[model samples]
Target chain A: MESLVNPYVSVDCVLLGFDGEQLNALVVRQSGNNGEDVAGIYKLPGSLINLDENLDEAAQRVLKQFTGLSQVNMLQFKAFGGPDRLKNPEDSVWLVRFYNLNHHIDRIVTIGYTTLLRIDRKMRKLEGGYEAQWMPISELPRLAFDHSAIVDEALKAVRAKATLDVTLLFDLLPNKFTAAQLRNVMEVVLGITLDVKNFHKKLAQMPYVVPLEEKEDGVNHRAARYYKFKKLKNKHI
Target chain B: MESLVNPYVSVDCVLLGFDGEQLNALVVRQSGNNGEDVAGIYKLPGSLINLDENLDEAAQRVLKQFTGLSQVNMLQFKAFGGPDRLKNPEDSVWLVRFYNLNHHIDRIVTIGYTTLLRIDRKMRKLEGGYEAQWMPISELPRLAFDHSAIVDEALKAVRAKATLDVTLLFDLLPNKFTAAQLRNVMEVVLGITLDVKNFHKKLAQMPYVVPLEEKEDGVNHRAARYYKFKKLKNKHI
Candidate 1:
């Protein structure tokens, strides 16, 4: 049987992982000719969707194939279908060689999907027969085929979602975390440096961030209080 | 010259309008055989994107062609690509006749775009040689294809966006709006009845909603104070 993939539509996954310090995005390097250097040609893990799978299924499959992680909650953020998306000769060449296409594919509307993962919790082993790594978002080199713009949009979407859904923040943190840790995650995600005093005041206003009875066990400085995310039935904002 | 349309990808728009009292969505009726009663069948304004235009352009074109509106800010929220999207015989027959397809089109992934409009402000004249009207969201009939789910998702997306960006709410309101009007918009979008006192307290804390030196005139009931939206330099949440 022939492969039943839709060449005009694809899905890309921006798998963001936080390692308690900085945010990183999982990217796969496009292999070059036998020994040629293609270090600068990294792109988001993506593929054209199969005829039988839905979009969400394709996103999940892409995430699993690239990162060797499954069951991660992914959000479909945007669809990128610019006519000039494949205008770059390098990108056109890569697509033809990568997918072994007999004919030229001038356009492909790719749906961008994103998900947040705890880097410390989930152990990542690159799969899908590609050279993949977690590159810190700040240090991401020039990506292939408008992928940098896709990553930028993913970051914006995650920030917008985190603002409305407090539970999303906890996904990047431990089960019980100190105020500073929570603040660190917010600062990284929001791309802003917040004042400690004001952050605590704002955190206090969030009734869902309930304080636990326990405090930090061991630390060089003053031990801080630990809090856990509590989901309220009628929580707004 | 052959048409440069890409049959595998399309754009669907959810044009939501607020009439100060209720929310409505613009839907186009698929005409039936020579004056046949196709009142029960309604679908969102959509079309397969042309190879020359991008996704956003396609969405704008769909909105303009269906409702005679242009330059509307439409946000791409989700992509619907289920294999069974066109499994309905009625939908398949309509698609074949409408697009004049020579071969079977088993799948066409649609990008969902949405925007809010003030029903009383914008004069809508249906175009694109189709019958169209604004249907109350509360009384929407069973839509064709997966549009019902798409509309539901659009509403959820708009509500999520409204919770984060106060400016989006202002789009549905006039330049100067009363407190009740704002609350009513929120109640309809959120699908919740908020307490008047609590809502007032919450509004008071928002620094962006600036009070104007104006009041409603020529009203049967007590005149209400007017307020306007102010974009803050560093607003969060």
Candidate 2:
């Protein structure tokens, strides 16, 4: 199995997307010879990087192919590698010399990646005849490999950032939104609803939020004030 | 490199032990050669598990073999696998079916492990002439694959736990120790010296950390009050 490690390194991406009220996972039911060595499982959409491709390109390509949606953001998580973690052990897969192994199985090493994508609730119908559902983070089934734990870690990160990083709320907004609609997204992600009256007051104070002086339409009676986040490149902290 | 994704799965343990104030990586530098492959420098001891071996057993056996020590404390991080993380796609090292691409390279997946052991610091010499240094975690060099990142993540976990987990400070103390020594380890880990008057008052108050009758030696002009953490089974959380 020492002969099994290869000429390319691959990354697995666990994408998390959110709406106004729910925190969801972007999972695709796996296809191929479902009944072969591996069967009856929905795993992360992962693949090996091309010989000339950088890791980002490989991850983006795999995500697009599996989800049929493009332009989502992805970030790298920790890497995984160890002996006997492979499906087939009798080749060069053990060639992953970085992982120190003592057992007989050839070691497998992988760089885990994550993405926070805007959900195209409608385009999900274009997926490969496989059921793709936005399962709540807590109820994910026994995932293939250590993916369950992977989601656990990624969620911690999302929750942590929800408080400090304001950009995440963009996922929940439907292109044009009222301040009240935007506040709903923040409440869901924060796991606690803030004082709506005070929240509106704070939004009005931020210089970057430009009030359009337009009113939301199709309401039962009086429409609410609408605004857009003045687009500014985030100067990373 | 496509040939490198083995269906077989396994785990790897990256055991980190702390002695008093400094950090140590429990690694065994190995040497072997393939046709044109050069075994370059790397860190940590590792192994693969038998088909019937539980993840915990594999980690324990690997730890005993590498350190001649058993009943060590540890945690599993993640599993890794992506075909072609290695260079040479072939040449068998372990028993699993692995596809190695070239000399000194392979696609591998590994489950990471982190631990805190109070091994006799004098027994630091590697049995096989492999160097095992209790080097400061801050000075780790570029490891093979993404191992450097693995250790980095572990350190982050340790740092995150420093504030709340009482057991984390135990590794730095002897079987019995003074509350002052425990506080010192916390300061080193958090990278900021805490306010002593309140820190001492707080540790004594925690139900889990009972004050010991013992006090420090004459080495200190004023012997500090000693306290010990109540021992428990695997303080992983």
Report the C-alpha lDDT of model 2 over A1-237, residue by residue, as the tens digit.
452232234567777665545666766554343322233455666765554455566777877876776766665555554433455422332223312223343333455767665556664453434455666565677665555666776666565555656765565566666787777767766667779779878887766677787897898978988887765764221
lDDT of 1 by residue, B1-237 (tens): 021122378889998988788898988887554534444689998887875788899888888887677887888888998788988878877765666565667788999999988776343544235677888899999999999999999999888877667667767777788889999998998777878988778789878798889999999999889998886553321
Report the lDDT tens digits of candidate 1 across residue range A38-137. Answer: 4458889898787678889888899788767787778889999888888788787777666656677878889999988777634355533577788899
**How displaced is residue B203 in candidate 1, in Å?**
6.5
Q: What share of the true interface contacts does each candidate keep?
A: 0.49, 0.03
- State residue A87's C-alpha deviation in candidate 2, in Å: 11
B95-144: candidate 2 lDDT, tens digit per residue: 22322324333334455666766646444654334455555676666665
Q: What local lDDT score does residue B60 receive in model 2, on the 0 to 100 scale?
A: 81
Top TM-score hit = 1
Q: Give all TM-scores, in the order shown.
A: 0.83, 0.63
Question: Which candidate has the top score in lDDT?
Answer: 1
The Cα error of candidate 2 at residue A93, in Å, is 22
| TM-score, model 1 to reference | 0.83
